[model samples]
Structures are given as C-alpha cells and as structure tokens.
Target: MAENRSILVVGLGRFGSAVATTLDSMGQDVLAVDKDPLLVNRWSSSIPTVQADMTDVLAIEQLNAADFDTAVVAIGDSVEASVITAGNLLDAGISDIWAKSVSKEHARILQRIGARHIVNAETDAGNRIGHLVSGNYLDYIELEGEYNVVKIHTPTYLIGYTIGDAKVLERYGITVVGIKSPGHEFEYGSSNLVMHRNDELIIMGKQDQIDRFIKG
Candidate 1:
C-alpha cells in the first residue's frame, strides 16, 4: 500500500517477473532475485535484480532481509523451493510474505511456514466457474457460509429504474444493491446509483434466490 516501502521479490519466473513489474509500476522499490544469471541480467534495469539460490541458507543470510519491508515468493514448479523460500523469509524476520501456490498441499505448506497471504490462480478460477453456472448470474462471491453478494447484468427489460423502485428484492427474492454502468469498473464503496441499459446491478441475498434471479 505504501509506495515508499521496499519489496523483495524471490524467483524470476513468469509469475515472479509479472509481480515485480507490477509493483515497480506502482512506484514500490523492488529487489528481484533469481538463481539464473541470465534472469538477473534480463531484468537488471527493469528492477534491481540479484542472482542467488533462495534455498541456500548462505544466499539468504548474505542478504539484508531487514532492509525489505515485504517479500513475495513467486517460485513456480518446485513447491519445495517455494515453501522453503517462504519459510526462509519468515525466519529472516520479514513479517509479510505473500506466496504463489501450485496446489492444495502447497497452499497448506505456505500457510504453515508463516506466509501472510497465498494466491492460487487455479482455485480462484474454479470458484468463478461455480458462480457462472449458478444462474444467468454475471458473478457471485460468498461473503461467508451464511450469505452471498452477487453482480448480475441488468436484462434489457429491467433497465431504467431506480434501485429501490426496481422491487427486485421483493419480486425476485434478491436485493438490487448497486448499479454499474457500461464504462464502470470497481466502484466498491459507491453503490447507490440508478440502473441503465448497459449498467450492472450488484445484489445480495441467499444463494438459491440469486440463482433463480439470474435464471429469470
């Protein structure tokens, strides 16, 4: 969140490169490390890169982990190395380590090693697939076991109505929470708006009712 905070990015694989580049673009100081010499050279100017095997205790010890505000373990293919890197960073007193996981086992191990956050591309997609088929649903996210907040594109017939006047909650058993316009993107805290032709409505209610609303 703080642009002034420095980040240590371990590994230089595709995922690692992308994450480092993204953070740098956001104005965060980054030290990108990889075992391959070529990898370090390739990204030298893109961000500060160091060539060192992260699994080696000496390599980790040689570096000043205290200088980094955060660490990201983006190692791919080898779950062992990924887990080890996360553990090493944790031991080095880097309190915030974000890890990229390959599988359920990898995710569990990363958590055990004190990774503060785990990002799994596969699991997130699988969760989205379940929501898509739940109905004509645009998207749905489970807030918890008890409730769900969903986004449904307004059908052409349902356009041109106020959120309260829509009566979607009473008629469809789903709340007409907020609307998104054709050009809208990620309006998180600002949701009180009217619906229009190309707008999207984000609603909340029981999952069963959400499915039915999307279907109708």
Candidate 2:
C-alpha cells in the first residue's frame, strides 16, 4: 500500500471539492479551505474545512501550508485568485504545488510562478475524447514530442503470427511492449510471443507509426 500524505486544498469550487474528497477517500489527510462560508459548510462534514481567503498570504500562513506534503490551487473561475493563492503557497514553502489552469496563458503563469504541476482539465479531456472517438484504441497517452502509448486489441491481420515472424518493429516501426490475454495477467512482449485474438497490446511509438500499424 502507498503511504498516506497530508494535502492542503485551496478553493471549494467543483474541481477543488473533487480533489479534496478524492484525496480523503485515498486515505490522505486533507485540509480543505475556501473563502465562501457556504462552500466550506457544504463540505465540512465530509472533510476538514477552514474558511479563509486563500488570496491573502496571512491566511495561508495561518493555515500552516508548509506542513502539508502537497498543495493544490483549484480556483478556476478567477485567474487572479488562483495565481495569488498559488503564490502564497509558494511563499509558505510548500514545494509540491499543483494549480488548475483555465487556459494556456493561465498555465504559463502558474508555471512561471513555480507551480510543480499544472492541471488543464478541459484541454486534457478534449484530447482524450478525440483519441477515443477514433475507435482504434481503448486508451491513449500522449508522451513528450512525437511519442505516444496506446492500449489496443491485436490487429486482425496479425492475430495468428508471432512477433518475430511478423517483423513488428522492422515492418511498422512500433513496439509491442506488453500484452494482456483475456482473463490472464499482463506479460512483457517478447519477440517469440504469439499474437492471439482477443489479446490486448500496449504499444509505444510515434503517432504516425501507430496509426499505420493499426490500419494494417
């Protein structure tokens, strides 16, 4: 099991509330803060709550933000409030700060303010939906530069061939790094591994190569 952590979550909007509740469910010690009394009251029974204006550095200090292992700024409606709250957390010496960004500019601002991670929820969801809509992949992950990783069923044309016989890498420029037979645990993809129908593959390669491989 993973070790539990102490997390400070500032803001009580949809994103903020979700983060706090999820962390609490995962056995993390979470202190949820917000400026609105109603927002704080709504979640007080569910998690630890502190009503305070997070934009105020003194308020952050009062909450002892630095003591938490991590902090998240989820004030998405107002960029000003979000930036101020994140900056205050930084001032309090919380090294691992994650901030929600409403736009590209907002993300850049958070990065410049020293936030360790920026969550662009809307943009990320859109990208994931675009990939899913294509019907080729069960799941997709975009990596740095041109690389991508995808989980997909073994293509029909390759169903009965072994990886060595098919010349997977030489022919398609993509790698089958892992395989999951239906009802069995996942295993590493070896060159001699035979491709079976209903088996799922975890493939890694450039997007174009993966696309072409899927088409075949």
Candidate 3:
C-alpha cells in the first residue's frame, strides 16, 4: 500500500473542497481551511476543517502549515488571496506548495510567491478529455514537455509476437515499461515475454511517437 500523506488545504471553493475530500478518501490526513464559515461547517464533519482566513500569516502559522507534507492554495478567484496564502505557506516553511491559477498572470504571481506547482484545472481537464476521445489511450499522464506515459490495449499487430520480435523500440520509438494481464498484477515487460491480445501495455515516450505507435 502507498504511504499516507498529511495535507493542508487552504480555501474551500469547489476545487479546494474536491482536493481535500479526495485526499481524505485516499487515507491522507487532511486539514481544510477557508474564510467562509458555511463552507467550513459543511465540510467539518467529513474532514478536519477550520474557518480561517488564509491570507493572514498569523492564522497560517497557527495552523502549523509546515508540519504537513504538502499544502495547496486553492483560492481560484482572487490573485491577491492566492499569492498571500502561498506566501504564508512559504513563510511557514512548507516546501511543497501547489497553487491554483486562473490565468497566466495568476500563475506567474504564484510562481513569484514560491509556489512549487501551479495547476490550471480547465486546461488539464480539456487535455484529459481530448485524450479520452482520441480512442487510443486508456489513460495518459503528461511527463515533462512533450513526453507522456500512456496505458493502451495491446495493438493487434503485436498480438502473437514476442516482445523482442515486436521491435517496439525500433518500430515505434517507445518503450513498453510494463504489461497488465487479465486477473493478474502488472509485470515488467521483459524482452522474451510474448504479447497477448488481452494485455494492457504501459508505454512511455514522446507524444508524437506514442501517437504514431497507436496509429500503427
């Protein structure tokens, strides 16, 4: 099982609430804070929640923000509030801080305020939906720049071939990192292993290469 994380989430807007509840359900210790008492009260029974203004440095310090493994400033609408909250988290020595960005300007502000990650939910959701509708990937995760890790059903062309015979690297410029078989756990993709129609492949490569491999 994966190790649980302790997370501090500031802001109780839609995105913040979603993040907090998801983390809590994943068995992480989550503490949620928001300026709105109604929002706090609504979530208090589900997770540890407090009605506190995140823009205030003293309030953040009182929360012991640095004690958590990660902190998220999910204040989406106000750039000022987001920056101030992110700054307070930094001041509190919370190293891993994620801030929501409504626009490029907001993202730059969060970056300047020392937020480690800036998430643009709309863009991310659009990308995910595009991939899902493409009919190629079962799931996809963007790695750095143009690279991606993708899960796909084994291609018909490789159904009866051994991994070595498939020439995945040479033909597709992608690597098969692992294979998930029906009713079995994932196994490393060994060169000598034979491919099966029902297997799912976890591949890693540049986006273009993955596209080509899928098209073939």
Candidate 4:
C-alpha cells in the first residue's frame, strides 16, 4: 500500500475529476475544488469537494493550500484562470504544483508563475496513442528524448533462441531487462535464457533501435 498524502485539486473538469477520484480511491486525502456548485455536489459524496472560484486568492488562502503536500491546477480552458490559480497556489507555499496547459504559451506562463510541472494533456495523449497504434509493441513509455521502455511479445524468429544468441544488444542496441513467460511472473532476463513463443520482453533503448528490432 502507498502512504496517503493530502492533495488539493483545483477545477473539476474531466482531467481534474479523474485525478481527484483516482487519488481518493487510492486512500489519499483529496480536496477537490470547483466553481460550479453542481460539479462540487456531484463529487462531494465520493470525494471531499468544495465550491470555490480558484482564481480568487482569498478563496485559495481560505483553503489553507499550504497544508496539502501537492496541488493540481487542472483548468485547461481558461489561461487567465489557470495562471491566477497557479499563482495563488505558489503564494500559499504549495511547492509542488502541477498545472494543465492547452498550448505552449500557456505552459510557459505556468512555468514562469512557479508551477513546478506543466502537463500538455492533448500532446501527451496523442503521443501515447501514436505509440500504441504502431503495431509493434504492446506498450511504450517515453523516457528521455528518443529513448523508450517497451513491452513486446517475443518475435517468432527468436522463439527458441537464447538472449545472447539473439544478439539483442549488439544488433538492436536494446537491453532485455526482463521477460515474462506464459502463466509466470516476470524474471530478470539472463543472456543464456531461452525465450518462448508466448513470452513477453520488457526492453529499453532508443526508439529507432526498438523500431528496427521490432521490424526484424
């Protein structure tokens, strides 16, 4: 189980609501705030929520934002509202603040206003989808720049080959970090370990190298 932490989420749009509900489900102390009374009332039974305008500095101060370990400004539609809300959270001494941004300009503004993190939700979602639909891997997570950690089904050509014989590192520049055989838990992959058809490989490398490995 994870340790519970107090979180303040401003705005109750789809993104904000998802974050609040997920955190609440994980047994975290979540305070969800929105200007809409209807939205606040709807989530109040499941998660602690209050009807308050996030842009109002006094309302933010009243919430005692400093008490929460983290704050999320999930107001993507309105640049002014998002900026003001993020500024207020910073002023209240919330050191870890994440803000949703609709554009590059919005992201820059949020960073300039002391938001510790800025999420471009649309771009991230698009990139994730692009990776998922590429048809080579089961899942992909972008690391730094062009690197990625990918989960892939063992290719047929390597079905009976050992990791070293497959030359994954030499030929593809990818490291097989772990492998999961059918009906078994993942184990650290060794160079001499033979792969099965139903096995899944957890590998990490540059995206181009991963693509080349998958293509072969």
Estimate candidate 1's alpha-carbon lDDT, on a 0 to 1 scale: 0.72
Q: After superposition, how far is residue 25 of candidate 1 from its true place, in Å?
A: 1.1
Off by over 4 Å in 2: 123-216
Name the candidate that leads on lDDT. 2
* Model 1 agreement with the true structure over 75-159: per-residue lDDT tens digits: 8779988888888888888887878888888999898878987878454433342333223457657686767887777765556
What is the TM-score of each predicted model, taking all chains together? 0.57, 0.60, 0.61, 0.60
Lowest summed lDDT window (length 10), candidate 2: 125-134
Off by over 4 Å in 4: 124-216
What residue pairs are clashing in model 2? none
The positional error of residue 86 in candidate 3, measured at the CA in angstroms, is: 0.1
User: Which tens-of-lDDT digit does each residue in 1-216 have in candidate 3?
Assistant: 123567788888777887777566545677989999999999999988998997887887788777887887888778888888898888888888877899998899888878887888676543442353234568778776778898998887788787789899998889999999899988998898777887889999987788678667
Whole-model Cα lDDT of every candidate shown, in order: 0.72, 0.82, 0.79, 0.80
Residue 143 Cα positional deviation in candidate 2, in Å, after optimal superposition: 20
lDDT of 2 by residue, 1-216 (tens): 123567888888877787777566545678989999999999999989999998887887788888887888888889999998999899888878878899999999999989987888675443442353234678788888998899988898899998889899999999999889988999898998888988999999987798788778
Instruction: Report the Cα lDDT for candidate 3.
Output: 0.79
Q: What is the lDDT of residue 67 in candidate 1?
A: 70
Which one is best on TM-score?
Answer: 3
Taking every candidate in turn, the Cα RMSD to the unseen true structure, in Å, is: 12.9, 12.4, 11.7, 12.2
Mark the regions of model 1 whose C-alpha exceeds 4 Å error after superposition.
Answer: 1-3, 123-216
